[model samples]
Target: MKRIYTIALLLASLTRVVAQEAEQTVSSKINQVAVFLQGAQITRHASVPLKAGVSILTLTGIAPAVQQQSIQVDGPASVKILSVSFRINYMEEHKKPEKIKLLDAERKRLTTLITQEKSIQEVYLEEENILKTNKSIGGTEKGVEVAELKAAMDYFRQRLLDIKQQLMQSERTIRSYQEELAKVDAQLTELRAIKGQPSGEIVVKVSTKAATTAELDVNYLVNEARWFPSYDIRAKNVKAPVGITYKANVSQQSGEDWENVTLTISSANPSEQGVRPIIKPWIVGYNNALSRRTVSGSMMTVTAGNEVHGKVMDDEGQPIPGVNVVVKGTSVGTVTDVNGNYSVPLTSDAEAVVFSFIGYNAIEKRLDKGSEINVQLAPDVTALNEVVTVGYATSGDDDSDDKSRIYGSSAQKMKREITATEVIRQTNVEFKLDEPFSIKSDGAVRATDMVEYELPAIYEYYCVPKLEEDAFLTAKIMDWDQYNFLEGEASLFFEGKYIGKSILDTRNTADTLVVSLGRDSNVLVKREKKKEYSSRQFVGSNQKVALAYEISIRNKKGLPISIVVEDQIPISNDKEITVDKLEDSHGEYDHNTGTLTWKKEIASGKTELITLKYAVRYPKGNRMLLE
Candidate 1:
């Protein structure tokens, strides 16, 4: 609803002869842009010349994605806005910037100068070549005196040198002109691309009692804008607090430039059709042949896909939660649950699936006629290296069997000029940008700096040589909720060195947030199998295997450190399989999961060794995954 204020003006009695009708086109400047997770609203200010009665003023250069009802027109009390309307002009041509004419003129001048420079250089080169080609000067001119022959030779040589110098100078000028022309060509190309897009207009009819200049603020909602949080977590050392560089990936394709406007990014989507959806009645009836044509609006339908289930693990074989698993060449994917397990449907044409996480290297694995794939992602050192790009991709209907060609993305990252402050809205969060920014009509993702924090934490070393050879360092932060972090990606830097990428999953987190700091080489860890005590034997109709392993850890650091050593034993699911006498030396054993954990504080320069032993008995002819 458009709100109009009816305030009386004391200076003038409202006298109307024939009502003065006028039409004025006003150009509005985008003063503020409120970007959300789903949509954006642009607030523009344009001052218009007003008569006493009614004037229909059109606000030009609007986006076609505007929701008509979301338009809000505000002005002073004396100016009563009568009606608001929107119209999309598809056939209307875009007006190129007047500066483009000046640019084109400069480009043409530079190009002409380059051509003239090249022509002069060519003539100089031709004359120099002709003079150099004549080597019969002495033989053809034998009648000439010796001093005159020497003078002729010197004169020819000087002319050739002079021509060469002229050519060199022309070549330099040509190169300069060519460089300037290239820049102008790029500018013209950009402008031309923008000149072909569609535009809309908003018309506002205002009735004022007297002639005055009226300031109008118009706001409208638009789609194709979003913002997500990204982080760069840096730890100078175990003793220093972690420094977090909070940033935002803001993106938009609002069909116009935002200009030097104050930008606000929000996690809330006001454009979303609110909750409390009406439940439609479910009718269950069998149709004879209609089942074959089940697609509602499509003429054809084909559903062919295979489900891929997998677990994502870290270097230590620890389940990594919140890892993204997507099919290659498709946006269809899902994230790993708290148990580090994901199940995504692979289209029949999909050859592989890519597993990605914040600090882990993304790996694409081929299906190879297998439904279960367990992957171990190595840590990528460039994980939190500072990304200035933003966008979102999500899985659509698996029943969509249309084998459309996957096109390459021409999308560019949107860049914001200033940082923002987070505001707590009624339903979601909003980040108000501190400085102004401008984004093009093309859908590009840009980044903006958000906030920074110094987090306090404790660091520890953890090792599980049974699964991985390396020892990993981890940081545990208390009261992580204070950061108000949403689920997103983060880059980790340990000891001022980039370790890898990791996820900031607050979904299933406990009171403390445990972040992996990547593998550590300074700590000493080793795992050894004792061949003397390990053997396989067949007793009666049963086969028996005995295994013994030793793990050693040393504290080589200057300060005492706490370490957690982990090992595991196999569990049997078959009735005939039996396991007995599993012993963990100086560690606690979990019966259900067959896990062993040893927590110890080792003094500087101290070494500790732990032993683990187990026996397995099964049928003679059977083989298990253990071997």
Candidate 2:
């Protein structure tokens, strides 16, 4: 019976030993990531040893914003991937098990020093009390010799001063320790908060028929990561091709530090809403009976918080970038990027949001729904005038403002559904970086290069003498649409020197794309009104003014350059006023815009002159201002 019991116990212990072991594997650090325009794809590798059975693997420390549905796994054919699962490690939410030992040690050291110094202070006070209790009196006190008393008195004074100095030094040291402690506490708080990146874990289930080592490839989607395109157009000379240094500004707040990883930036963002907007029926009516259905224009003040997300667009539904989005009566504001998309986070007291951009009229919209609130700002006539001057725009402060489209024509209104699979074909731009990159979780503008194209360009000199005497050098690039470009700030360089800046306008309707390469100091131009030939006369209650102007351009450089010198003739606004009898020497005039353009060539050290004469007639009873 005893031998049978012993055998049963041994068998039971052996059975328990078999159940104690489990199959679990740890994944390696992320080695590659594909970042899109708004999101990123993170990949991690893992090798698991299977023993002809099922096994489980967990990849820790992934981004919290990772989409579980996008997670994918790949491995050897023999290794069967059973299931892939994502979960947040809630254990970390309540407490962080790890700590910086060095910081904690230093804190303890400083605390000990403060406590010792305070204890020493109490001893000094006790010693001072003892000295006071020992002060001698006339009766029942041993009166020492005068020299001895004087010596004792001097010793007491010096000791007190020394003690006071020690206390002050200790207090100063305490303050210094406190400051350092505050900084240490801030770091500790940051560590405790676990901010700057969202951290989580990934788990994968696998099974195998035979024992083998399988390499597991895992990929997941994470948000708060993006890359945008920018360019640097540099031209060495008029004959050379414009050097376009295509750059990508990659920014991410995703939790993991992508250290020495393979990075690929795609023009794809699956987060973008691909749902086509449904247009409601528009009923246009001026009937008086419809007025009764109108709501009040006056809005009651909003005393609570409201957050809104929206796109700033034109009336034609084109995105308007760099619009200032501000909550009314608050200093908190932000400007839209090149995409013209803005997300406004409001305070509790925010009433409404105001959108303002150059060339567009200011708009104030009240937040009603939490969803997207698209606002279309109409083009202001005065603002349009400031941007479009002499057929060239330079005063537009908005980065998205099109130079050639100051008075933009309406675009076709069509709702189109765009999806992730079709995004690459739609965008037609994938910025292939030169090499591998490792970006920290910190939000920063990191640049990478794309391929450079040397397309053919024609250089021309342009001068608007009435506005400025300087002749700007422009390079007209053909087939500009071949390169997918977003309207952005361009730094222009010419002739081996950094000249200035120019805006790259892709929306301009022309056979060739024009880029201003800045001014040429060698080409001198001037416009002057001939005062001797200009006069004003009163004839039959009408005032007639005659004006003459001359413009000259000299080519001081060695190259013979063709210049387009531009000047304009004013037109009257009133029916009684007449502007006629014009004398143009060059005969290059646009009657519609009253603009005179001279496309002529001036040889080296040679000069060319253009003259214009016109008359303006207005009624004498009223005053008129003319340009």
Candidate 3:
């Protein structure tokens, strides 16, 4: 018996060894194959051989979204996969088996209890129906024979109460079973998820056309595992219309699932297009201010074929009349009339022209090709140096050698010499009257009997600057009243042309005369007054009279000047009259015919006052008067 027992033990030990060897062979083959998780392209090779009893695998960088049983070995394996265990944390994998085992036991316990609760509820319903039937029989018998009925009622009541209590208890047990069943279901659902294998490396490709640098951050999760891809793309000496792409290969475990994958690429140059080019004008002048001139007036006209025309004014901006204008060098020039305009011809050879007037500075302008030219002339304070107006003519001492001399008598001088009486006679008188008279002892005279006379006269004279003639003189006296005395009749002549005119008129009683000179000039004036009267004494008695006279001279000049006045008075008395206040006064006086003589040396361009007053008495009845 001992021998047979030993042999049987040997056979049993041999069978156990064969089973262990088969399990090892299956695990080796399974471990040799790569495992891949759902949603991940990378495959993971086993670090350690998987045995036939193994139900879980730990992986790095694996996706969490992998489904249970989704993990598969790509190569042949001996054992089929029955279940998969998944865990977010690697350490949780170690406890997965125990948790799954406890869940299965709880599920079995709940299933058994649920069946027992359902059977007890059925029994409670049957007892409730029996108690109802007993109550109905008792009510039908009324008070007849209740001895055994009480016993039956008591037993039925007890059984009914017990059954109701059991039913209530069953309901509570069923509720607790349902709660346990829910917990088990949740555990089963969690355990069904497949754990992904680790993806050791991955490959990433980036493409761009910008001439700049780029950087990328890629984050991926596989089976609740996370991985980050960090890289930078740099471009050097890159030009436009050029593109490049970066490719990299990274390795990772195969069973990892990709989740929450974020790939971001940032570049240094953000623009997709190139830049373009720009262009600006030239300016000139000081302070951007322009110099301008204007020429204007009535009698003058300014015309420039290709030149600008404008108005001319004085320093105070007042228009000046009769201005002389000329070019700078050449003799191309013209004079401004009363309107202050001059159309000085431009010279083709001249580069610039000068504009000059009597009291203004000469202005020069460069000849521009434009049709307009404007210039401004400043005031010339030294205008007295050229063509200054003297007593009766203009002196050319101040002019340049090439300039023509301005020779003309001033209107003031000629108007002053011609009296109002002469002008009236020239305008109105028909026949000339000539009578000689002499100074008397008392400076009084009587004229012979003559007819009454009334007549008007007119006179005019003109002086102009000599341009061609050397010297000339002319005179004319008209008849009748056709030529009457009026203002602005006396004209001045220098050389031969008229420069200006003077107006002379008599006062209210045809006694006092006033003279108005047009232009500025020196003047010399003369005036005469004469009167005649006659009377016969009774019988042969002699007649005489007294005469009184006053003479005054007013000089109008800045400096001392000279003035001479001569008077011829007719005298009838033989006795010589004595003159008074002669030397001490303005001039010497004559008392022979009551005639007074005044001579004075006045100042230059100034008015001097000369006055003479005297009285004379003649024989009674002898008439004495002035004519």
Q: lDDT winner among the candidates?
A: 1
Candidate 3: tens digits of C-alpha lDDT, residues 1-627: 999999999999887555433422111111111111111222333323433333233333333333323343422233333433333443322222455577788899889889988987987897788678656544555763577778877888788888888888889889988877865764453343222212222222122222222222222222221111111111111110101111111122213222222211111111112233254333556665343334433222322212333445456554444333434433233333333344443333435655544224767666554424444456655421122111111111111121111111111111211101222222122111123212111101111211121221111111221111111111111121232221112333433345443222111113322221122244334231212222223323333232333333334435333333454445444663322232224444455554445544445555443333333444454444433
Ranking by lDDT: 1, 2, 3
Better of 2 and 3 by lDDT: 2
Tens-place lDDT per residue, model 2, 450-499, is 55555556667888888888988877765566565544445677767776
Which run of 10 residues does model 3 get worst, by summed lDDT? 235-244
Off by over 4 Å in 3: 1-98, 134-143, 195-223, 226-627
Candidate 2 stretches greater than 4 Å from native: 1-25, 50-56, 74-85, 90-198, 205-214, 277-280, 287-427, 571-574
Clashes of each: 9, 1, 100
Off by over 4 Å in 1: 1-22, 91-195, 209-213, 270-273, 277-419, 442-445
Output the lDDT of residue 260, model 3.
22
lDDT of each: 0.70, 0.66, 0.34
Name the candidate that leads on TM-score: 1
Q: Give each model a TM-score.
A: 0.61, 0.59, 0.20
Q: Which of the predicted structures, 1 or 2, would earn the higher lDDT when compared with the native?
A: 1
Q: Give RMSD to native, each candidate.
A: 15.5, 15.4, 58.2
lDDT of 1 by residue, 1-627 (tens): 123223333212343323455557898989998876556878999988787788889898887657677788999999998999988777764565565778989988997888888888888888888887875655554677789879988999899889978988888888888777766764553344345555788999888888899999999877545555667787777766666777776655556777888988766655444545587656555874533445435212212224678788878786666565765644345566656788765444556777765345779887664789999988767422122222222211121121221111121212222367777755666677777787765344466778777766566778888877677777666667756666555678976778877655554467867666788776789999988978889989999999989899888888777778998888888889888756678698888998899877788899988888889999988877652
